[model samples]
Target: MTDRDADAALDRAADEALALFADDRRSSGDRRESHVRRPQRASDVAETVRWNVADWAAADWGGPVPQDAHAADSVSNGASNSSASDSPADGSSKGSSFNDELFNSDPFSEAASADRPAPDDRSRQPDSSPEPNRPPEPNQTTEPDQPADVPNEAPEARAHATPWRAARTAAARAAQPLPSVVRPLGEALGQTLAEPLAALTDLPSFDTSAMDGWAVAGPGPWRLPSKDATPEGTGTSTRTSTGTGTGILAGHAEAAPLSDGDAVRIATGARVPPGATAVLRSEHGKVRGEGRELYASRHITQGQDIRPRGQECRRGDALLPAGALVTPVVLGLAAAAGYDELTVTSRPRVEVLVLGDELLRAGLPHDGRIRDALGPLLGPWLRALGADVVATRHVGDDPEALHTAVSASTADVVVTTGGTAAGPVDHVHPTLRRLGAEQLVDGVQVRPGHPMLLARLAPGRYLVGLPGNPLAAVSGLLTLAEPLLRTLSARPAPPPYRARLTEAVQGHPVDTRLIPVVYQHGDRACPLRFHGPAMLRGIAAADALAVVPPGGADQGAEAEILDLPWTADGIGISADTATGTITGTGGTP
Candidate 1:
C-alpha cells in the first residue's frame, strides 16, 4: 500500500480502537479478542490486508469486515463477490452505460458512472451512470456529493435485482401486522380495527323523538295532557319521569304514559312516552285556544318524527368489520356505540436514518453540503401511509455508526434515506450484510427509484432503503414503504384506478416509468415537467403518478394511476390545453 493509503488505514484502525474504548453498550471482556476482524478464506485477504496488532489478531476470523476499496484490492468486498485491483467497487465493466442499467438488466448497484470514470476495469451503478463513451449532455446534472471516482457495489447484485411488481409484492409479504393494541379513541385515529366494532349498547336505545314535537297517543286534535302528570307507563315503552316535566327534555327520565287521544310536548332526542303511537312535529301541529287541544296541520303518520329503538344498530351487532380504518367518522360512530377505547392493529413503528455526510438539516446548500429534503418529506408522508414514525435520526455515512443505529433500533421498521447506491460512502449494503438482514427486494425495474430496497432485519422487523434523490425517494415511498406499512398496519389496499393520458409519454425500453401527473379536462392524466429523479417540483403539484408501461404510451391511452394524498400546501398543475403541455405551480424544492 502507498504511504497515503497506509496512513488512512491506520487512522481508521485508531478511530475504531478509540470507539471501542468509549463504547458504553458493550462489555469490557468482549474486547479480549483482536479488534481486526479478518476473513476466513485465504484468497479473501492480501498479505497487506492482514495486520499484526498483537498475537490475538488472528487470520481465521469469520465475520464482516468493512474495507476501503483503494486500501487494498485483495481485501474482499462485503458481499459474496471478488474484487479487482483496479476494478470499480461494483463488478460491472468500465464500459457499462446508464441506458443498459435502465433497460435490459437488473439494477441493484447504484453506480455513479456518469459523475466519474469507472476504474479502468471497474464499475459502480446508480441513477447518474452516464452512457458509455458519451459526453454528458449540457443539460445533464450530477447528483450532490458524487465525486469523479468512488467505490461502488459488485455488478453481481445489479444483475439480479427484482422487477417492480415483484419487489412491491415481496415487500408487502416480508412481515405480518404487529400485535393489536387497545388505544383510547383519542389515540386510535388512523389505526386499523383489530376486532369487529360491536356495539356496546343499541344505538338510540329507546324510542325517541326525532324532532321538537308532541308525542300523541292515537291521533292529535286529541285532548292535551297536563305537563305535570306523573310519567307512568300505560304501554310497554313507558320510562319513569325524573322531575316535573316542562315537557319531556332530552336527558330527563322517561315521561308519563300518554292516555289514548292525549298528547304531551316533547323535545328532540327525548324518550317517547308509553302509549304514544306517533310523533307530530312542532311545525306540523297547532294548539287551539286555551291550549286545551292539539291539531295536526299536516297528516301525522304512526311512528313519524320518532327514532325507534336500535334505529342505527342493535346491541352486540357489528358496526364495522375488523381491518376497518379508524377515521374521524369512525371515531364518532364508536363513541356513539359506547366505546371509550378501540382495539386496533398496532401501527408499524419506524425509525428513519438520514444518511450522507453532505447533508444539512437547516440551511441553504453551501460549503459542499446540500439541504436534506427527504428528512422532512418522509415523516409526514409515512404518517399519511399509516405508520408511526418513532424517530428520524441523522446517521451520517459511517459504516459503524449505521450499523450501531440499525442494530439498536427497537422500531418495527427502520427506514434509511441515501447511501443505497454502491458508492464509496454507501455503507447501507455493507451494514445490512453485517446484521444478517435478508434483502427482500434488492432493486427495482423502475426509473428514478430503481435502487430502492426492502430487507428483513429480524422476524418482525424490517428496513427500507430509499435513494438519495428527492423524487426518487418519493417513488420508493409509494412503491415499497407504502405497501409495507399498509400490510403491517392491517389496512386495506386502495383500489387500483386508471386514467387516460392527455398526451403521449415516452417509456423506458424495458423498465417501468413512474411519471408525475395531474388530472386534466375530461379526467385525463397530464404529465408534468421536472419529473426527473432528483427533482421534486413535478411531484409537489401532481395529483397522482401515471404508471407508463414499457415502450411508452400514446396520447389518450389509459394508464394506471396512483393517487397522492391531498394537501392544502400543494401546488397545482396548470395545463396548456392548446399545446397539451403541463406546467406545475410547485416551485423548485
Candidate 2:
C-alpha cells in the first residue's frame, strides 16, 4: 500500500481512538472538563502517545522534559496547558482514567496493525516507481534510486529529512574529488590514487636467482669456480682474487657470464648472469672433489629457481585502479613498481569548531561544568577517517563568534559541534540562515543524532553541524560527514557489511537507531549497554555501529554494519571511572 494510504488509515484510526477517549470520559463524567492534550492529526497521535506513555504509566503528569540535544523538537512542540482534575466527588462515576484506559488497551494498536501488512501479503512490497515530489516510506529500502527520487543538491527536498541510505547517497554525490596532487611516497599513505598506478618499469626488473646455490648453465654436473687448482676430471678457477668473492650477492655488481658446463655460486635475489639456465639450491646440490665440481643431488631443470623480469607485472601495467585507497601494502607495491612520487587525491581539509561554553577543557567537572569530550574526540577521529583536520577550536555559544569562525574557515569542510537544535542557546541554525547556506540535509531520521545537519557553504565546500553529546556527535560523524569526506577524497565506499544480531534490540518507533555493537561468536553482532545518545561508554568499546531499522530488530536479524575508523586496529577508549576522560585516543572522548 502507498505511504499516504497508510498514513490516512492511521489518521482514521487515531481519530477514532481520540473520539473513544472523549466519549468514555463524557459518559462517566459529572461535567468535568477533559484536559488531556491531543494531536492535531492522526500522524501525530502516535508521537503524542509515546511522549506521554511514560508519564501515564507512572500515574503522574511529570514536569516538562528538559530542552536538550537529545530531546527531539517534535516531542517538545506538543505542550499541554491542561490536565485532569486532581479530585472528583464521584470517584466511582469518574470510571477508569485515560491512564487506566491506556494501560488496559493499546491506543494505536489498530493503527499499527493496519499500517503493517502481513508477511505473505503481496501488497507489502514498496513501490519501485514513485511519482514526482514523492517521499520514500520509512521502511522502504532504497537501491540507488533515480535523481528525482533522491535529491542530491536541491533545497526543495529539504522539506523532509532524507532517508538514511538516500542521505548517504546524496552526500556522496554532492561533492567531487578535490584535485590530484603528486606527493612523495612517504606522505601518500591514507590518500586515494587520483590516477591508475601503472608500473613505471618491470617488476623485479631483471632475471634473478631464487636460490642460494649454483647458477648453472646447461644442466647438472657442471664444473665449479673454486680457489683450488683443477684436479684430474675436475675443474675451475678461484673467484676471490680475480673478482670480490666467489658467490654473487644481492645489491652487488653483476657476475661474469657463465659458459656451458661452468657454474658459479649465487645468493638469493642476486641477478642471474646471461646464459644461465637454472639455479640449483644449496641443499639440493652436492659438492664433489672438495668443492671443485658441482652435481645436483636432485635432478635440476632449466629456468628452475629463477624470477623472470616482469614476473609480477610489465611496464605501464595498472597496479591499482584510480580511487584505490593507498594503504601500507599499496605503498610497498608502488615502491616495488619503481614509484618515488605518486599522484593521489588530496586529503579533504576539515576544520572542527567545537561549540559550547559549559564544557571544561581540563580538570574534573566542578560548578556545573563538564569536561569537553568532543574536542579531544573529533580531531584524531577525523584524521583516522582520512581527513586532514587542520584545526579544532572551541567556538563558544555566542552567535557572532560562531559566524566568524565558520565564515573564516578556509578548510574544505567545516564541522561544528553542538548548537543545531532550536534551544535558546542553539545558534547553528541562525548562523546558517544568516550565511545563506543551502542546507542539503536539515536533519536525519536517525536516533541520537537526528539534529545533525549538512549545508553547502559554496560549490565543493560544505558544513556539517554535529550534536554536542559525544555519542550523538559520533553518529553525526558517521551519518553525514563520513560520506561527504569519503567522496571528496575520492576514496572508494566500503562494501556493505552485515551481521546477524545475537539478541533483540528495541528500536525507535519512527526513526532509525544506530546501536553500538560488538562482534561475538564469529559474525554475530551483540549490542552493548549504555548506548544512550549522551553516553559514550558503549560506543567507546564498540566494533561497529549497527543500523537497526525502525520497530527494532529481532534475534538473528541481519543489520547493516557501519565500521568504526578504529575498528581495524581495534580502536577503543577506556572510559575514566569518573566519566571525565577516556584514557585513549589522546583525547577525552
lDDT of 1 at 63: 11
lDDT of 2 at 161: 65
Per-residue CA lDDT of model 2 for 1-589, tens digit only, reads 8756776676565545444434543353112112233333344555433333322211111111222211222334454312212223111125765433221211122332344333223223344453556654543323221111111122432347667777777788889889999999988888899999999999889999888877899966887765543322212322542231267777765567789998887779988887799998888877777566777888877799999999999999988999988888889999998889999998898888888777778889987678989978887787777888777777666888888888988999999888876666789888999999998988777766777889999887899999877788898999999899989998888889899998665554446778778888879988765565667877777789899886567778999999998775321132222322222211232
Per residue, candidate 1 scores C-alpha lDDT tens digits across 1-589 of 8645554565455445434322421232121112232322233233214221111111111011222322332332334333433455333577976532222111112231233222221112332433465543332223311111112444554466678878878878877888999999988888899999999998988999999877889965777644444445322232223221346778777677778898877778888988898988777877775565788888878888889999898999989999998888899999999999999999888888888777777769987678889877777777777777777778766888889889998989988988787777888898899999998888887776777889899999999999887888898987899889989999888788789987666554446778888787857888765566677876777788888775567778899998884431121122213312111111122
Please give the CA lDDT of all the candidate structures: 0.66, 0.68
- How far does residue 554 in candidate 2 sit from its true spot (Å)? 0.7
Q: Which stretches of model 1 miss by more than 4 angstroms?
A: 1-154, 226-245, 566-589
Over the full model, what C-alpha lDDT does candidate 1 score relative to the true structure? 0.66
State model 2's lDDT.
Answer: 0.68
Clashes of 1: 14
| After superposition, candidate 2 runs with Cα above 4 Å error | 1-159, 228-245, 568-589
**Each candidate structure's count of clashing pairs:** 14, 0
Candidate 1 deviation (Cα RMSD) = 18.7
